[model samples]
Target: MAIASVATEYVFSDFLLKDAKEPKYKGVRLELALDKIVTILAVGLPLFLISLAFAQEVSVGTQITCFTPFNFSMKQAVYVDSFCWAAVQYQADNSPLWLHKFFPYILLLIAILMSVPAALWRFTGVPYLSSDLNFIMEELDRFYNHAIKLAKNLATLDDRDAEQDSQSALDLAEGCFKYPLVEQYLKTKGFSCGLVVKYMVCQCLTLLVLLLSCVYLCYYIFLASLVDEFPCDVRTGMLKNDSAIPAAVQCKMVAVGVFRLLSYINLGVYLLLTPLVVLAALGPARQSSSFLQAYEMLPGFGALSKFKPIYNDLSIYLLFLKENLSELKSFKCLQVLELLQQSAEEGFDTMCVLQTLSQVKTDVFDSQKMGSITNICEMDKPKN
Candidate 1:
């Protein structure tokens, strides 16, 4: 039993190690770490402040305090406080002073406005970009695998047959090297500037909102400092003709100081974030070269070069299928046909095989079947 266990462990350990050594590629991140951090802070700070202001209001119990006449009864004084509190809005003569009443709500609005850009990116841009990147990465991976297989085949060729083998290998490499799927995809997508435009627009919008918010906060601070207290007219409704009740009462807004403090904090943070936002907006422009240029220039001839062997192998297989399509009638051939069908269904270019099949025009491969398959393949092709 111990010998069996040892044998099993020895056999499986290499497999586990090999799996562990395999390279894992995560597709590109659309937003940088700094940009994401800044976005969270910029949109989140205002909300936190708003919540703090609300909690303060709740704990303090009243936003307005009215000083009633000493001559009035307790109930009358209470009425005076309630009436003055309700009429506090009427006491403000200017629009700026009136804004103080809705300070928390305004802060909430600022938070929501600041978050719009991030929200838009998450909902609209991220999925589309992520999927596009994943598809490109998958194709690149397949190309890499094909290149590896071709290298192994070339390595095993006998020295005596070197001339013929080298020629065939060279031919295979030539076919594989032509019309790279990723390069073709990039070329087709190169004209579409929609994603770039969307990204830039989002950054600009965020910057604009930040600047406007800072201006509003500064303005709020200026106005809030001027008048936290206002005189309220209590003589209204039932108390309108009452001689005992004072005609006017002095009422002070309880949360104005707290609101002012929150505004200052919000303004300070936004000012810090302003440059970061600007940098994020201009990031794409800084990398003016084509998107894949950096990847192509990496050491060891980069990703595409490393996959050349597998590409050559794939080319050889394609050539074999093309030359002897009718001669190969085994289950493996049917499986290859099924794979071609699947690839056509998935919108891959299988036109080479289709063309070869057309030439043969065998009973097994009828014209109507070919036509329907061709139509399906064409229909499956992606629209730009």
Candidate 2:
């Protein structure tokens, strides 16, 4: 009979283990979809437009036009235009006009600057944060399965005249349920704010770059409009004292109009993006404040309080029992005991657990209730 009973117990335990489903873990996305779309557009549009401008210049085969003297042949006129464009550094009084010559290169530089923050986050920040989140999620899954198995074992115990032995068994099982791994890991990571600080820095850098690029674009547009045409000094090097070559030639940059148009497009898009960058910068601060407020409201609970499982109010209830068991009357205690046993045997939904706690309050505690009890058991609903 003893051997038969032991074999039956093994079968029952195996059945319960097979019946408990392991929770599914979904990966957390480091960047929001909207933010990613905005980054690509804001950084990529100008680059694309600048490439188009360069293509236009190449197809036309002339970036500047300069008229030579009437006596010069077609080849000499071409030489004059080519020489002037190659050395097209125009100086009015003391101010320089080099920006007009290298407008496309400047736009390319701006595009590179705009993309730096996203690249930095992707390479340095995302990997570390992702690994940490995965570790935490896996640990939480293990803790949840452990709790369910303990509850099932407790429920399967004999509920006969061995009441004292059953209570002792419950204490022993609870003692074994302690998970020091998660707590120790958290303690080691408590002082590190590397990920949070990295996120904030990235946002701030993006915002600053956006503002500066807007200002630079506005300045370029204003200056380009005023000084697209300038007098070029062709009387240099070989033509320093030549009587045939003129000392100065009036020349006009052909790509200035296109550059101004590209600047306007870039400025319009960046102006629209300014508000998004501001909001992104503020997101972490708002979340941190809200999280701190919630944590402050819970007195005895520590950092891992945020990690309650979706279907396991009994785990938290057990913690409360450990603390307040002596204070509870026999009738209230019996109600809790019965609730735990039933939950372990048949399983319970969140609503049923809530109703049971409310009954315990109204029946034995004279309508006085612990507000934190409700807060603790309000686990996040699993996403479908």
Model 1 bad stretches (over 4 Å): 1-32, 73-75, 288-384
Over 1-384, each residue of candidate 2 has an lDDT whose tens digit, in order, gives 465346435533542223226432233555655457657977898789888888979987998888678998999878877877776664655433567778778878878887888888888777875565446444433443354345445434554634676587667655654434544464455445676566667778888888898998898888655676667787877778898877788878788788888889989999998888887655443331121122221112145555332212222122222333233232233344344334332333332232234334323433133333333334322236
Best by TM-score: 1
Give the C-alpha miss distance for residue 330 in model 2, angstroms: 35
RMSD of 2: 12.4
Each model's backbone clash number: 6, 0
lDDT of 1 at 366: 55
Give the range where candidate 2 is weakest over 10 consecutive residues by summed lDDT. Answer: 289-298
- Candidates in order, TM-scores: namely 0.67, 0.63
